[model samples]
Target: MVSRMFRIETGDDKDRRDLLRRRLLETNTAASPVLRALRGTPAERQRPLHLWVMDEADELAGGLVGHTWTTWLHVTYLWVDGRHRGTGLGSRLLAEAERAATERGCDAARLETWDFQAPDFYRGHGYRETGRTEGIPGGHQDVHFHKVLAG
Candidate 1:
């Protein structure tokens, strides 16, 4: 049997902004109870945040949240629905994000994930492990990865 995928496009700036707003609200709703507790209690101010939504079949399949600083494009988060794993959709979304970074003149992309997440998946796509922090809140070390782009 063949599977079908549909892309929902938010065409204009206003539409994209609205879509992002809704996505954030949905993400906050789905986050764990602990995260919800710390949601708005940051002690310090931070840089601007940007969000991109990946919608497939009218549902949110994944999302990319990041910000560009100087020469680097830091990917704060990249998530795909659990049911949609191993479907090539993550790769497609990452490629799109890479293209966007290149267009924005970023020299590289960086992100971090726990061991239980998709470290192997990123490594398969040319990302290299750059740093690691042991014993995070849940006893899992966070691994940082980076992918430098050719101009």
Candidate 2:
């Protein structure tokens, strides 16, 4: 039997990261017919979707930040200032983002919120709990939610 020798190193390197990402994309595209078909299509790329609410003084109140890719809107963050919570601003922002995503041909939306966060708010907005990860920070659960957008 023959043995091989190689070095396994890890660090934050931009050029290496880019090369690795390109290689992985190529491999995935080659392995999956769906991904191969998406190459060079608009739906293949993730586009940012953000909505912001401002107060009368032009300060930030609440916002939603996420991206749309392949018929889905992934909401990464949604936050409202403590003074603005429970004022419906968050709902409005979320609604607007969903509208824009639907216009972009998305049929579904998803987001993750901690147990201490707005799981109930999402439920009230017609989202359903699809899964959960326990033992998150503060010993809480990370809840995942999904909603079928009104397209």
Candidate 3:
């Protein structure tokens, strides 16, 4: 057997990151038939992304971006402009996403929120905190929320 030392690259490199991600996915998929099957599902093969925006004066006010997968709508990002906060736009955006997800055969929605983010706002919209991890970044917490979509 031959032994060799490998050099490690440091700093932000999008190409390297993407290459690593591809390699890891390939390795995982090759090792497990279950993983391959899961990824080959009818719904998994189709990953459509959606972005709902709230615009004012040709400027961005708020938006909801997510993707519906199989049985869950993963809310990637939800942001409302500070001036537009508390105007129910956030709730409306969430409701709109949920509606789209339901139409796509999704039965639930899930998202992760930072401690400084609107976890309470999501809770008010029928999402419940399913998990929490503290000390994420300088005493901050990461909260996971999930909501069942209406059929």
Candidate 4:
């Protein structure tokens, strides 16, 4: 017979985050050994990238937040101020980011938006719907898109 001891803690511990990261990487590597080479990918190769527009005196107007890995740019968030929307600023920001990503050897870009968000706007930028899932609290669904760079 064999016995196992278990302990449960319900709180956030900053120091334990590193332990969780190690465990996650180990489990993934066990599942697929090819992923071992990505041990420090987020810190080394996939460091976050950002683009922003500023008004006079350097006040923030709009911006993007994302990271790149293995020739793919993952757009986590893209936003423009209310005063900047519909003024082409958002399109310019995204286009510039795509150009930069192409220069960095990225082959594609990906992002997600909701039903009420700018999915159609992304389509105008050459992104195409890849997949989607419905059933949010509201009637909105999460939509994912991808665009190939011209590099």
Alpha-carbon TM-score of each model against the true structure? 0.62, 0.81, 0.72, 0.78
lDDT over C-alpha atoms for residue 72 of model 3:
83
The sequence of per-residue lDDT tens digits that candidate 3 reaches over residues 19-125 is 78667766766787755766454434336556556475768888887877656899999888998988988888888888888887788889999978888888888
- Tens digits of lDDT, candidate 1, 66-151: 76543467878888888877888778777777777776566798889899998998998889999999989888989999999766
Candidate 4 wrongly placed segments (more than 4 Å): 1-3, 6-42
| Candidate 1 regions with alpha-carbon error over 4 angstroms | 1-57
- Model 4 root-mean-square deviation: 3.1
lDDT values for all models: 0.72, 0.88, 0.80, 0.82
The candidate with the higher lDDT, 3 or 4, is 4
Model 2 pairs whose backbones collide: none
Q: In order, what is each prediction's RMSD in angstroms?
A: 16.4, 3.2, 3.4, 3.1
Give the residue spans of candidate 2 off by over 4 A.
1-27, 39-44
Task: Write the number of the candidate with greater TM-score, choosing between 1 and 2.
Answer: 2
TM-score of predicted structure 2? 0.81
Residue pair clashes in candidate 3: none
Best by TM-score: 2
Tens-place lDDT per residue, model 4, 4-88, is 8889898888779767865765666667655555445533445567998898778899999997764788898899989879999
- Give the candidate order by descending TM-score: 2, 4, 3, 1
lDDT of 2 by residue, 4-45 (tens): 988999889999886786677577777878766763644245
Candidate 4 lDDT for residue 119: 92
